[model samples]
Target: MPMEIRLVRIDDRLIHGQVATVWAKVTKVNRILVVSDDVAKDILRKTLLKQASPPGVIVNVITIDKMISIFNDPKFNDFKSMLLFTSPRDARRVVEGGVKLDTINIGGMSFSDGKKMITNAVAVNSEDIEDLKYLNEQGIKLEIRKVVADNKVYMMDLLKKEKMI
Candidate 1:
């Protein structure tokens, strides 16, 4: 069965103003499926995220396993949803677990210790590079674009140029 996953985006701040008002309009996605164990279990964060979504858009906070299950289920085949993951590992899990995607977007990861800052908001570590390499090997197109209007930079090429991997 084919899943109507319009966008597979890795954004730390999920369902915020830009995502709710801009990306949703550009992608035309009605549902936003946030796949993350940490966020799924956080009541306050989850509620805040839910409230951030636009009035007509449905936002679902689920774990990686739950997203895998949902992808396997036939009921969501027709749902036009954006799959949001907090990390590359989380995105890799769903893709490796039988979910299909031709493209993946990296919006933000935030700078942190032991992580190389690739873009203004995207910082990647060794594990993230490995996950990205795996996805590239699987023939998934990867790009770094903060918002819909921004010009997307091919992530793998950027990694090669920066010698991060």
Candidate 2:
């Protein structure tokens, strides 16, 4: 079977209200893979996050290490999985570790000190900007978009303006 994955969105708040309410329904995704080392280590947190997901959706919280192991396995490619990551560092780690994917959709990365605000909903620090540029150089599409309906913001454009890339 040809497996399909949609909306590889990077949001700090993983599997939350917006994800469950908007992105999940819009993408018609059946599986959600949250790639986070923190969640993977904590059994209680993983259980809570799993419970937060809607009834029909199969949610899996896996560490970067575990994700790499699974991604290397051909059998893992059989399922339609939407990959979610918390930060650009994690995303870069996954890519650097050889997790292949075409595009990465950026959603809500909140504003923090030392991070330049991309938009009201999105922000980027020097590290994240560099990561985005690196991903772009790797021929991966880096799009900063809030939702399916929002306009696509290219990482290259953001880099040029911010001079971070």
- What are the clashing pairs of model 2? none
Model 2 misplacement above 4 A: 1-4
Candidate 2 weakest ten by summed lDDT: 1-10
lDDT tens digits by residue: candidate 2, 54-150: 7678899999988777876767666567889988888888889887778998888988899888677788888887788778878889888776788
Give residue 35's lDDT in candidate 1 (0 to 100): 93
Candidate 1 ranges beyond 4 A from true positions: none
lDDT values of the candidates?
Answer: 0.89, 0.82
Error of 1 at 132 (Å): 0.7
TM-score of each: 0.96, 0.88
For candidate 1, write residues 1-165 as lDDT tens digits.
765889889989877778888889888988999999999999999998888887678898999888888885788877789989899999998888878888999999978899988888899999999999999999999999888999989999999999876
